[model samples]
Structures are given as structure tokens and as C-alpha cells.
Target chain A: MVKLTADNIEMRFGERLLYRFQHLSLAQNQTIHLQGDNGSGKTTLMKMFAGLIAPSSGEINIQGADSLPWWRRNPLLGKAVYLHQHPYLFEGSVAANLSYVHSLCEGDKATIMARTEQAAKLAQLDHLMQQNAANLSGGERQRLAIARAWIMQPKLLMLDEPTSNMDKLSQELVLTLIKDLQKQGTGMLISSHQACVLTQLCNQMWKIEQQGLTSTQHTPTMAKYSNTGQSQEFSYVTAS
Target chain B: MNDGWLALIQQALSLLFSLDPEVWSIVSVSFSVSFAALAITLIPSLILGFILAFGRFPGRWLVTNLIQTLQSIPTVVIGLLVYLMLTRMGPLGDLKWLFTQKGMILGQMLICAPVLVAMSQAAFTSVDRRAWETSRTLGASWARAVWTVCRELKVPLLMAIVAAFSRILTEVGCSMMVGGNIADVTRNIPTAIALETSKGDFAQAIALGLVLLILSLVLNFTLGTLRGKAEPRSH
Candidate 1:
């Protein structure tokens, strides 16, 4: 089942063009890795795909929803979620952050509570439920954010640099949780610099090159050793 | 240092603490008028501030600049403009609100609306844009997203409210011109202070001054407390 489709997507700020895409589509349970340099418009594309931003000229249809301006009143809501590189942890306990996602639904209190608990455990945040999310360490906050997003059970989840600030252990845990979500049929688009690790879970790889999206399939490994003896894999996809 | 000054201050304190009826009456009127003005402008100012902060439209900069400019305009100029409007020969004459508490409220509201708008806009602008996007991505309505942003900015919003309140509460020019300083009706604290001082009734003037000083201190204290509460949660 197709979860989302974008046709002729283009984004520009005034006279400066950011990116343009001919077409893109996501199927149920598909995981796509998006790789790009710092200023290559990767985050902007994800935001537009999630309906958080309007494209300069294009149509992005999510779950057959009409197009941009997908308001909360739109039924397409609760079906998609986007996590920023540095997600905002609201001014409250970590539990409150998880509960916020459940609050948006129309379920009974007990059912929502169960889901929140389940999400917390999945993200390995069950012990930090009472802690203030704002004061949490970077990895814990990212885990909390993922748990919060999972509780909503969005069909399509877009994550920007979900593991950038995480330690190797934390990154492994996050990828494990994401793999679990994929098994349950959650389509995902992830933007990250850790290509070797992320590509392992990706079925499709997309990169921004020459102001447009370039598609590739997952390679056996993007782990290439550089002359400096550092493990740098993916080529830096800079803007033209 | 002077015995006469100390004596006058003592008399003023005695009258203030003794619940002098005439002095209390002016204080009551002051509170009522300023509170009314704030109540009238609060909702509209918040709405305009949010629009200015987040809404993308042509001429947004012009509107923001206009509100900022209005905030710095002299209170007496606003008083004079409102006076012309409320005078018998002016456009709003038929309301017959001149020299009434309502007229003072109207003048104060005029002075406060832009002040509230400018400050609240700055507060809203300071909120992380990610908050809005995250809320919407989580299925919050636009209004709910805006409300969440406001929740995140409770401290700054309170400061804006306190600022607008203080500006109208202590301003004498608008109150004097439009309220006409009528005793038992429009004789608010600032107008009363001005009148009493000119009339050489130092006791009354000093008492009103003391009241203003306490009010300002209380407001700053509350602002400081809010800042303390907000620091840990703010990013």
C-alpha cells in the first residue's frame, strides 16, 4: 500500500532555489534513508512531506489526502509524524511528553495509558517516565521523542538525524526500536549522516544531488575507510 | 533630612494605612479603570500578536513596525488625540463618555493595545518554531498549536500583561485629559497625585506616590519569580 506520494516537489526561498523532485513514493513498511550534506535541503524535504511546510510548487499526497495545508481537522492527521533533529521536549515530565501524543486521539484513558507505557518501554524510557524531559541527556531526550512519536502510531514517520547525538549503544537501541516499528508496517523516511548504520535498515536510499532527489538501492555496506584512518562512508552530497 | 519632610511623609503614611475614605476611593477608581482597559484589549492584543509573530503575509513588517512605533509614542499625544475624539464637536462625541471612567478606560486601552501587541509579539517570536511544527505534526489544530506555544511562553506573556497594566495604571496624562480629574468618579491615583501636588497637598500626593512605588515593586517581584520558574524548562 502506498503511504505517500509527492509529485514535482519544489522548494525555494525567494530567488534562491532549494530543491526540486520529479516524483517520490513510500509504501507501507518501507524504510528510506535520505543522505545529504548540512545545507542540502534534506530537512526541508521531510518537513514538506509531513505537511508541516508547504512546497513552493508541487502536490504531496499523504495516505490519499488532498495536498498541503493538511490541518489537524484533516483526517490525515494522526497518520503522520515528523521528528526534528533536535526535538522539543515540552515543559513537563517525560511521561507528559509521551501522554501528549495519546491525548490527541479519541481513546479511553486506560487504553491511552497502556499505549504510552508500551511506547516508553519500547524506547527504553520506562525508567525515566517521571524525569523532566527538558533536563534529560541528549540520548534520553531523543529516545523520549521517538517513544512519544510511536505512541501516536503514525503510519508514516519522518525522522531528521534521529541518532546524531546518540552514543553507539543508544543508536543501536533506537534502530532496534525503529526496526520493530517497521515490522508492524510503519513507513519511515530518515535523514542522517550515519549512512553505514542507517543503510542497514533501509530498503531504499535517496540523496539530494544537483538540487534534486537521486535514488539508489541499499548497498551491502557504506562503511569505507578514509585515508585519515577514520570510518567515513558516504560522499558529502553538497548543493550545486 | 528635613523635619518638615519627615512630618509630611508620616502624615501621608498614617492616612494611607488608616484607610482614609477619599484616598481609598481614588485607588479603587484607578484599579477599576485600568483593569477595564486591560480586559477590553487583552484578547485582541494576543490575537494580533500571534498573527504578527507567525503569519506570513505581505506588509507584515510594516504592521510590526507600526505597532513598535505606537508603543513609544508619548502618552500625552495619545491623550490629546483621544480628547479630540471624545469632545462634543469630534467624531465620537455622541457617546458622551468624556470625563467619565469609560472615557479614561478608552484612552488607556488605546495606549495599551499597541504596547501589548508589541511585547506579546516579541514573546511569541521567541518561542521555538519547532514547537508549532511538533504540535501540528502530533495532530493539534492550528489554534491548539498556538495555544501550546502560548503555554510554553506563559512567563513572557505574563510580563507583557504586567507591562501593559503598568503603563496604563501609572499614566497621568491620558487620565487627566479624558477623565477630567472629577472627584469621586475619575480621580484615579496618578491624576489625584498630579492634582494634589499642584494644590500643595503634599500628604495626598506622597501617599499616592507610595502606592505606585509598592505596585511597581510588586510587579517586578512577580516577574522575577516567573523568571525563576521558567529557567529550568526554557531551552
Candidate 2:
């Protein structure tokens, strides 16, 4: 099923055309890799898709309800989550951040706590759950971001450069987590410069060139890692 | 100069610690009237401040400019306006609010509201837009996003409150004009100081001035502490 669609979207800043798309659709359980240079509107497009901002001219329909408020429209179909290039953590502990999303979920307190615990375990942050999120290292914050969204079980997850400035270990954990999310039939739209890490997981690749989205292709084999249950080490050299 | 100043300070302290009835009554009236005004003005000013900080609408710039202008207007001007509106021949004359504590409260609220709005708007606007966006994208409603912003910027918001309170509490012009400086009715600290000075009661005037000075010092101390503790971007 086509879970989301954007028809003839246009983004303009004053007289300059930033980018435009004729038609775009994300089916259930699909993963689309977005490749673009810095300041190429990749984040802008993601924000529009998430209904955080409105395009200059376009219709974004989610599960046939086009006119519902962005926040309200998500629940009508399923949740849509957008992750910032650098995710923001509330001023509190990791558990507090997780509990924020948990409270937003439709569940009682006990269920919320249980899901929060499960997510912390999945993100390998259980031990640090009581620690302040701001005090966490960069890789830990990235993992926390994934964990924060994971507990919500969004139908469509839009991640903007989730693994840009990380060591190999953090990259593998994020990729592994992305793969896990894919297995659960979540539609993922990811924008990243590290195409080597995403090639194996993304079935379709789209690139922004000359103010338009053009489909591209890449082939890279996945470097398997040992099943040590922690951040797996990888020996793959990422392309410049 | 040294002896005269020291003597005045000594006299002021003696009067203050002695809990002089007339002086204490004046202080009590000042606090009650200004606190009532502060409480009434806080909610609406905060709401307006948040709106001004985040809202995009027609004439938004104009409204902000108007609030900024009001923030700097002399307190005596505000007093005159309130006096006109509350006089027997004025539009609000039926309420007979002039020369009453309630009348004084109305005038102080007018004085404080604009200060609160202007300062708090700046406080809220200083916050990163990303915080609000993240909260909303994560499923918070508009009001909830604002509440989150308030939580994130608690230090600045409290500073705005304390600043507004200080502005209204020490202002003499508005209380004097609207309260008529009536003894045991609406006579407050500032007005009492003015009367005592006019009557050549320098000791009493110095005592009241000392109290106002102490209050200012205490408020500023709190502001300094809050600045040390404030981590507006901690989120």
C-alpha cells in the first residue's frame, strides 16, 4: 500500500527555486535512500513530508486524508517520525527522554514503562537510562534518538543524516537498528552522505540534482560483523 | 558628608527595626496592592508574551513595537491616563475605583503588563526554534510545545516575572495619582515617602527610601542568582 504521497511539490525561497518533485510515493515497508549535497534541500524535503513545514505548492496526502492537520493526520493512518540531523534531547535523563515519547503513545503507565525499558535495552542504553541525555557522548545521543523513535513504532520514519559524525561502531549500530526497523515493515526515508553503509538496506535510491529528484543506483556488499550484542565493528571504508 | 550620611542610615535602621505603626502600615499597603496587581497581570502577560514570541500574524511587528513603547513610557503618564479613565466624569466612573486600593491595583497592572510582555517575549524568542519543533513533531500540541519551551527556559521566564514585579513595586507615580495617597486607605511606601519629604520629615522619608532600596537589592540579587542557574539551552 502507498502509505504516503507528495504530488507536484515545489519549494521556493523568494525567486529562487530550491527544488521540486513531480510525484513521490512511499509504500508500506519500503526504504528510500536520499542522496544530496549539503544545503541541497534534503532536510527541507523531509520536513515537508513530516508536515513540519508546508511546501509552496503541493498536496501531501497520507492514507487518503489530505486536509487533516499534520499532527492529527499521522494517527489516522499511522505515526510519522522525523529525526533532526542533530537530534535534540530534553533537559533530563535518558529515561526521561524515552518517557516523553512513551507518554505520547496511547497506553497506561505500566505499559509505557515496559515499552521504555524494552527500547532502552534495544538501544543498549539501559545502564545509562538514569544519566542526563546532554551528558551522553555523540554516539550515545544518536542511539538515544533511534531508541526515542523506536518506542513510538512510527509507520514512516524520516531520518536526516543519522550517522554522519560517528565512529565505525556507532555506524554499524545505527545500520543494524535501521535493518531491524525495516524488518518490522516501517517505511524509511534516509538522507546520508555515507552511501556505503546504506546501499545494502535501501531498495531504492533517489538523489537531488539540478533542483529535481532523480533515481540513482549503487551496489555495495554488507560487511558482516560479529554478534557480540554491543556496537559491532566494521572494516568497510566509506566513500568520500 | 560622612557623619550626616551615617546618621541618616542609623535613623533609618532604627525606624525600620522598631516596626513603626505608620511606616509598617504603609509598607503593608504597598505590598498588598502591588502583589494583587502582579498576580492579576502575570497570566495574561505571559500568554501574550508567548504569543508574541512565536506567533506570525499581520501587524505582529506593530504590536511588538507598541508593547516596547509602553514598556518605556513614564509611570506618571500611565497614572494620568488611568486617572482620567477612572474619574467621576470618566468612562469608568461608575465603578468609583479612583483613590481606592483596587484603583491602585488597576494602575499597577497596566504598568507591569507591558514590561512583562516585552521582557518575556525576548526570553521566549531567545530559545532555539529547534526545541519547539522537536516537541511538536514528537506529538505535542501547540500549548504543550509552549509548555515545554517554558520548562526548558524556566530560568529566563522567572527572571521576566521578577523583573516585572520589581518595576511595579517601586513605581511611585501610578500609586500616588490613582490612590490619592489617602492615609490608611491607599497610602503606600513611595507615596508616603513623598509626603514625608514634603512635610520636612527627613527621617521618615529616609526610612521608606531605605526599604525601597532593600527591596530593589533583594530582587536584583535574585536575578543574579537566576542568571547563574539559568541554562536556557540545556535541552
Best-matching candidate per lDDT: 1
Q: Judged by lDDT against the true structure, how good is candidate 2?
A: 0.81
A195-229: candidate 2 lDDT, tens digit per residue: 54644577677788799987544333344433443
Report per-candidate TM-score of chain A alone: 0.84, 0.83
Could you give the interface RMSD of candidate 2 in angstroms? 3.3
Q: Each candidate: what lDDT? A: 0.83, 0.81
Q: DockQ of each model against the real complex?
A: 0.49, 0.39
Determine the backbone clash count of candidate 2: 0
Scored against the true structure, residue A234 in model 2 reaches a CA lDDT of 27
Cα lDDT tens digits for candidate 1, B161-196: 999999999999989999999999999999899899
The 10-residue segment of model 1 chain A with minimum total lDDT is A222-231
Question: Which predicted model would earn the best TM-score?
Answer: 1
Model 1 residue runs over 4 Å out of place are: A64-78, A216-240, B232-235
Candidate 1 TM-score to native:
0.90
